[model samples]
Target: MNMTSYEEMFDEYVKSSAAYCASLFEATEYFFKANAALEATIVSTNTAKTSTIHSIQEYFETCKISLIKTIDLLRTFQEIHTTIPGEQVEVDFAQQYFYIKKTLSCVEQIIQLFSTVRDDKNLQQQIWDNDDFTTYFTTSADSISQAIIWQCNFAKRANLDESI
Candidate 1:
């Protein structure tokens, strides 16, 4: 496939990923509201809260997997085009830089929200007290961080400003 086709695929992935991140943020907000309501009603049970945490964790895992796949696709594109002429590659890199910036913004928002959720006293206790949950959450966060780092490195290699 040509660079244009790769660009199209990258665009679609970014759009989808951004939409997914937005939905996850919204869901987290809703979860907070629901938890508050349950607490106000004196009906907030540990089981219900734990279930919600699990649901959010699952969502995080799905997002992480999607990001990793997207990064792999980007790596494949880079490897295949490694021998392309400089001028053409630079043009393609310039376009990809914007897409990467947009993706970084979405990922950063999700990361911040995830940190908030993870740091909540109740959620922290539940996650930390469970060995499996602790490992899962940690692994998910690490994987996502690595994916972000890979993208940043790619931008740097292309001589794009890190500020993006």
Candidate 2:
């Protein structure tokens, strides 16, 4: 089997997305805290407010969208290797830079999205205002930070060394 540049980058990209999927379950706690806060504020209003579960649903929906995009990117990357078979073809790193960059960008976007959604201060403050805001906030923040750590560690292992 020939290892094309596409295969190399695709493998790395799969690792990136797969790690995100694994960590997302753990990541739910962060959003859960944020959602609890958002629900409190939204529910308190006279008008209909988005429920905590609903917001979480929306978030996972967003994650689904990201997943689709990631899978599509993988398919496109895989396509590059499909045309030729049984030949040891060398893939140029320089040549695949754009696709690799795009994959990296997708990973960054997912990480940033997770960070932002999990740490929306206004919603957090509103949700736990009646309770202990400080502890709630700290714990929630820590969860997001951990997610970032998980992502960064995976990147480092893959020799990407990106601090997501």
Candidate 3:
């Protein structure tokens, strides 16, 4: 394959991964909000909150699916890059590696938050209202955004095609 084709593939991978990451982040935020609302409802009402729980679960599932898709896209790009002749590819592998690691770290933070929410149903209020949790969430979101921006910039530079 030609250099242009590889560059095009890389551009697509970066854009697709960024989109998935954005989706994952948004879903997680919604999940937290839904769970917080459910907790408040539970505290105020004596009736079952099955529907609220189900809705929160759906948001959680979306996050998981988006994370998986993003990871798969990164891995596929890496695999393809490695298989291609070195002379035909101009991507900076080191930058790609670090970007992947940084993005994965952000994803791991979300997974940890998910586990915390899943394991302890009683601490929803504390988790949702805590300043530390807010900071943590914001930091993770910022990191993901920075990583995506860096990746897009790198892809543009590598491709030499400003259209991306």
Candidate 4:
């Protein structure tokens, strides 16, 4: 509509897009963390990984809610996160980028959001437990770079149109 209104909308879109990116990184981190926790469960009880899995699942939900005001808001604008065919799931990144660039996008967004927050360990731990974010982030940029390379090769072989 108006100039300020446009800026506000652009800002909102950036915030939401950043959130969408944030959730994926959070979920990926949760996946690896849960994987470790699940291993512990298997050794201790030889039982299901239910507790660890549930914990990770809960984290994902918290991430989703924290990322958006409402589910409808998410459905309305998550273009950056693409869906796969057949299952028609709402998700992000190809399997090739699973552990690389795709994951880095999340880490960057979370850091940006958390940078503005102050002294809130509870909130921090809620998205990502403890302070091992740096550990996961150390090689993030490089990994993402590798993913970009793979995506380029894949696109050429598949003869797909350039990504919009």
Clashing pairs counted in every model: 0, 1, 0, 1
> What stretches of model 4 exceed 4 Å from their correct place?
43-73, 79-164
Highest lDDT model number: 3
Tens digit of per-residue lDDT, candidate 2, span 27-68: 344345444645564545343554443455455445444444
- lDDT string, candidate 4, 76-128, tens digits: 43442232122222234344435443444554454554444343224334435
Give the poorly placed runs of model 1, Cα more than 4 Å off.
1-58, 87-125, 160-164
Q: List per-prediction Cα lDDT, in the order shown.
A: 0.46, 0.45, 0.54, 0.44
Which runs of model 3 end up more than 4 angstroms from their true locations? 1-57, 86-128, 161-164
Q: List the residue pairs that clash in candidate 4.
A: 101-144
Give the clash count for model 4: 1
Q: Between which residue pairs do clashes occur in model 1?
A: none
Model 2: colliding residue pairs: 37-127
Q: Could you tell me every candidate's TM-score relative to the true structure?
A: 0.38, 0.32, 0.47, 0.34
Q: Write the per-residue lDDT of candidate 1 for residues 1-164, one digit (tens) a residue.
A: 78997777666655554554444344334434433442332333444433453454355445544554454455455544553433422324444434433443444444445454542346545444656544543443444444345445644755554443
Comparing 3 with 4 on lDDT, the higher-scoring candidate is: 3
lDDT of 2 at 37: 45
Candidate 2 is scored at a TM of 0.32
Candidate structures ordered by TM-score, highest first? 3, 1, 4, 2
